[model samples]
Target: MAALCGLTSMHKIWDKLFKRGEFTELDVDEEVAGFAELLRERNARRVLDLGCGAGRHILHLSKLGFGVH
Candidate 1:
């Protein structure tokens, strides 16, 4: 029960931050471009972006010809 309450509080904080665009950068991370290049070299066609806040990486990966989830 305590853990659930903590999780709920954390979720609310994050939700507020997201609503304010705190971590919502439209530009992809610098590391992601290099990582995507490596994926391409390996013939990777899909990516799973865990904890994908705001979906910036999703958009970038999709633009680079990889399916993103």
Candidate 2:
């Protein structure tokens, strides 16, 4: 499945089919773990989540203390 969705580029397509319901919560930890480092370093309090779609990422980001604007 990784190769099919371009394993190297997984983020954008991950939620399309995988990030839903129980599975949605699973991805949250990993995405936050990875991006949190950057957010802290850059002090990215306000997040502009383009193509937010159902807003799964937005919710997670907000929980982590981001303004999520």
Candidate 3:
């Protein structure tokens, strides 16, 4: 999660790689679930999507009710 990530280039790559442009609803849902689960397991109180150039993960985390800083 934010506390564990670098908030660097890797996040930008994730934004592109996880782009939902061509993803189906199920795929998006799965991604959200997976991300949320990871955060939960990490007990992350904050999340920072590294290199969130386009804010993809930022938006996703927000949608998941995370108070991104």
Better of 1 and 3 by TM-score: 1
Against the reference, the lDDT scores of all candidates come to 0.86, 0.71, 0.68
Candidate 3 local lDDT, residue 9: 68
Candidate 1's C-alpha runs over 4 A off are 52-54
Taking all chains together, each candidate's TM-score versus the true structure is 0.78, 0.51, 0.44
lDDT of 3 at 11: 64
lDDT, candidate 2, 1-69, per-residue tens: 758668646666665657555345435656667887689899778888786465677787788899876
Q: List clash counts for every candidate, in order.
A: 0, 0, 2
Estimate candidate 1's alpha-carbon lDDT, on a 0 to 1 scale.
Answer: 0.86
**Cα error of candidate 2 at position 59, Å:** 0.5
TM-score between model 3 and native = 0.44
Which digits, one per residue and each the tens of the lDDT, describe model 1 over residues 1-57?
Answer: 999999999999989998998877778777988989999999999999896466787
lDDT, residue 10, candidate 2: 62
User: What's every prediction's RMSD, in angstroms?
Assistant: 1.9, 8.2, 10.3
Cα displacement (angstroms), candidate 1, residue 32, comes to 1.0
